[model samples]
Target: MDKIATVKWLDNLCLVGQTSSGHAVVMDGPPDIGGQNLGPRPMEMVLLGLGGCTAVDVIMMLQKSNQAVVDCHIEVSAERAETIPKVYTKIHVHYVVKGRELSEAKVARAVNLSSEKYCSVSKMLEQSAEVTHDFEIVELS
Candidate 1:
């Protein structure tokens, strides 16, 4: 299915993005670029999307497997090119899974599946950036 979104200029270097699904997000540039830094940059939103997409996939997969998941966090980091149209060169994703007696093997498998097959954002970014992932499981007392 095709998704639709619109970004409207709010003010100097600030814009508001609205999705067809009825979600909204604010974006802005740095002060040097005439922005107030009121919100995240557009590139930062890309990383956020990547992290959110994969986190959802991993959490859902774990829950489907009957794992007692309590919390899931995803950290995404990236490097951009030095030239104009600076696109991401490399991206790294880290997953921290918290639960009771979670199987290490299952957690690893879920992370792998999300990065390799399930996450659409990951697949799209990997076209131009080298995307890699790792995970750590935190056992609950």
Candidate 2:
């Protein structure tokens, strides 16, 4: 994998990640110290990356099961220990799925499967953080 980052302006950074497929993702950083609204904070990017990874796992799993997944949202909250490392002690993930007559059992099962076996992000997080998951299903109006 190849990536690049070019300095744009004061306290601002533009980052890119290149995949083996010749695809790229551009990200940015801001001067957190001076409150420069240049780009997203690093910690925010970590959460977003984790969310994106798990989201793909959940959506693809539900789709493969023919669950008619119209929409799926996952909210993640992590408790960081107040120390130098500031490692996350616990993480709570709440998944809200929307579709036409979606199944609660299927949603729960999908989330379980992802956290337990499917989602690489969840598994990676499990090494250092206590990750938990819950879900709510909404039927189309």
Candidate 3:
């Protein structure tokens, strides 16, 4: 399937983007780069996209395995190259999964499947960055 997006400049280092699904997001650069902090930086959005993509896959997989997934949070940290056309050189994704009686094996499997096979964003970034992952499980009473 093909995806489409439209971006319109919103003056002074800011832009409004609309996805083919009609969802909209605002992107801007730093004040030094002429942004007024109106929204997230474009690079930040890439991190968010990776997190969102993997989180969805994990949650769905856990649900399918009958795991009680009450909450799921993903944190992504990245380092960008210090060169022209800066790009991500390294990325680490940490997942915090909360639920009652969560199985570690199942959770690990879910995470591995997403990072290794399911998440397109993660796979794409792997070409330019070293993507690594870890997870922590929080059991609820």
Candidate 4:
């Protein structure tokens, strides 16, 4: 599938971009970079994308496994290279999963599968960054 987006410069260091799916996002650099802190930085969007990608996979895998998952949250952290062409060097995805009778093995397996096999974002980021994951299961009565 081919995806596309258009980024329109809104102001100094600020831009508004829209995806082929018609979803819009605002981006800007830090104040030091001439941005007024209008929205998320472009690099920060990458982290958000990664989180969204893996969260979807984990939820889908749990559903397919007949796991009763009520909620799922992911915290993504990363370290970026300090030099030019700055890129992510290391990344971590921490998942908080909630449900009833949520099997520990299933949760781990789902996260592993997403990180190792299913999540395209994870796979792509792993090419440049060391991606790691940890998950916690919260049971609800």
Q: How does candidate 3 fare on TM-score?
A: 0.98
Taking all chains together, each candidate's TM-score versus the true structure is 0.97, 0.78, 0.98, 0.95
Residue-by-residue lDDT tens digits, candidate 4, 73-134: 99999999999889999999999999999999999999999999999989999999999999
Per-residue alpha-carbon lDDT of model 3 for 10-77, expressed as tens digits? 89999999999999999998899789999999999999999999999999999999999999999999
Give the Å error, residue 90, model 4: 0.3
- Predictions: Cα RMSD each: 1.0, 3.5, 1.0, 1.2
Candidate 2, 40-134: lDDT as tens digits: 65566666667787788888888888888888888988888899687777988888899987777877777888889987877887898899988
lDDT of 2: 0.74
TM-score of 1: 0.97
Candidate 4, number of clashes: 0
- Candidates sorted by lDDT, best first: 3, 1, 4, 2
In model 1, where is the ten-residue run with the lowest total lDDT?
A: 1-10
For model 2, the run of ten residues with the poorest summed lDDT: 3-12
Q: What C-alpha lDDT, on a 0 to 100 scale, does residue 37 get in candidate 3?
A: 93
Query: Which residue pairs of candidate 3 clash?
Result: none
Off by over 4 Å in 2: 1-32
